[model samples]
Target: MIPLKDNIPSRRFPLVTLTLIIINTLVWLFERSLGPSMENLIFAFGVTPADLFQYGLVSQLFFMTTAMFMHGGWMHFLGNMLYLWIFGDNVEDRMGKFRFLIFYLITGYIATLAHVLSDPTSTSPLIGASGAIAGVLGGYFVLFPHAKVLTLIPIFIFIQIIHIPALYFLGFWFLLQIFNQTFQGAQSVAFLAHIGGFAAGALLVKFFQKYRY
Candidate 1:
């Protein structure tokens, strides 16, 4: 399901969310400009669990954060940023800009660790903001369960845009992550990371909630 928008409105400008989207776009542009050097860049910046064994502490830690800002392809980038655009604004609003930024980075790190725990020896490079955005969705689920998400769900020949409660939308999303992780056995997508990030955001949202405007 593609979320077109949410019913909830932000009281303040979503500076953080807009900033994130812009940063991601700029990073994507830089990655594209790399041309043949793209593979090298992704390897250097993207999180590889095996790198933990090879690189120094600082470098390994840096990879975890850098991986979130990188993307493997245009579709991968768009899907992640779309989720962030739909849900991140309200999350930023609730947590406030400074706190929300902290929450986002921490949850993303947790998400990366989750993938690492899944297979610590794997050399595959994990990249993209889906895991971090999954954290945002988890927080949204906790904070606005009843809010309606206008989703574009395709069925047969017709694509339908329907309003789904945030609880169900996010619940089903989390479930899909688990389901794929359990049965699919990790093809290309990082299911474990999504599961971990979602759990972190859902559990941590209450503590992070602050009215700073």
Candidate 2:
């Protein structure tokens, strides 16, 4: 199932969400322009647990921030940006632009930390904005459980769009992450980062409920 959109509308302009989308898109384009040379970019910017643990300084700091912009592939970038565009506006509308931006970065950093903790020795560089976008999903799930998500369900070659309850869709997504992370044992993709960002979003929303405005 692919999410095409959602029914929830924001009362205010989600500048932060839009800005983040632009930034991510630009970064992806830049990496794509590099073609085979993108590996060099990933090695420099993408998070590597081994580098963090060994170098333990500026390299780690750069990766912690840069990792959020680096993505493994086209689908990876589109899927994450789609989720952010769908759910991020509502959260940003409630939290205000600045706070929402900060919240996103914090959850993203926490997600990266979770990835590092899981595989501190792996040389594979962790990349993608899903972890951060997962946080937006997490927050939206909490704040608007009843919201409707318009999704495209594919059956063989047939495709149909339907609206599903936010709780059901988001809940299923989260559970799938946990299930995959547990059974796959961290082989491909940082499923644990998704879980961590989701948890962070849920907890952070609780922590600053009053500030949600």
Candidate 3:
């Protein structure tokens, strides 16, 4: 299911969300410019679970944060940005700019750590914003459970558009991650990171919102 938009409107400008999107876009463009050297960039900046454990806290922090802004391909980049554009605004609106920014980074870090812990021996470099965007999805799930999301469901040859509640939509998404991780066993995507990020966001959103806006 692809989420096109949501029913809940943001009361405040989603400056942080927009800025994050811009930064990710620019970083992706830079990655494209790297051409043949893009592999080098991914190794340098992306989080490799085994290598991540061998690094110092500073270097580990560097990889965890930098990885979120990078993408593996056009599909990866566009999919993440679409979800962020659809769901991130309301989350940013609820948490305010600074808190939301902090929340995003923290959840992303936690997501990376979750992936590391899941398979510390694996050597693949994890990239993209799906994990962090998963956090935003989790926050949206908690903050706006009743909100409706206009989703695109492709049923083989036909496409169906339906309004799904945030609760069911995100719940299914989280479950799908688990299902993929359990059965698929880590193909290219880091399902554990998505799971961890979503869990982190759901657990942390209330605490982040407790502070004065």
List model 2 lDDT by residue over 153-178, tens digit each: 99999998999999999999999999
* Residue 58 lDDT in candidate 2: 61
Clash counts per candidate, in order, are: 0, 0, 0
Q: What is the TM-score of each candidate against the true structure?
A: 0.95, 0.93, 0.95
Give stretches of model 3 more than 4 Å off: 210-213
Q: Comparing 1 and 2 by lDDT, which wins?
A: 1
| Ten-residue region with minimum lDDT total, candidate 3 | 204-213
State the TM-score for model 2: 0.93
Clashing residue pairs found in predicted model 1: none
Winner of 2 and 3 under TM-score: 3
The residue-by-residue lDDT of candidate 3 on 47-131, one tens digit each, is 8888878874466887888999999999999999999999999998888899999999999988988888988888889998988
Candidate 2 lDDT for residue 43: 84
User: What lDDT does each candidate get?
Assistant: 0.91, 0.86, 0.91
Residue 8, candidate 2: how far off, in angstroms? 1.4
Per-residue error (Å), model 1, residue 198: 0.3
Task: Please give, for residues 79-108, the per-residue lDDT of candidate 1 as tens digits.
Answer: 999999999999998999998998998889
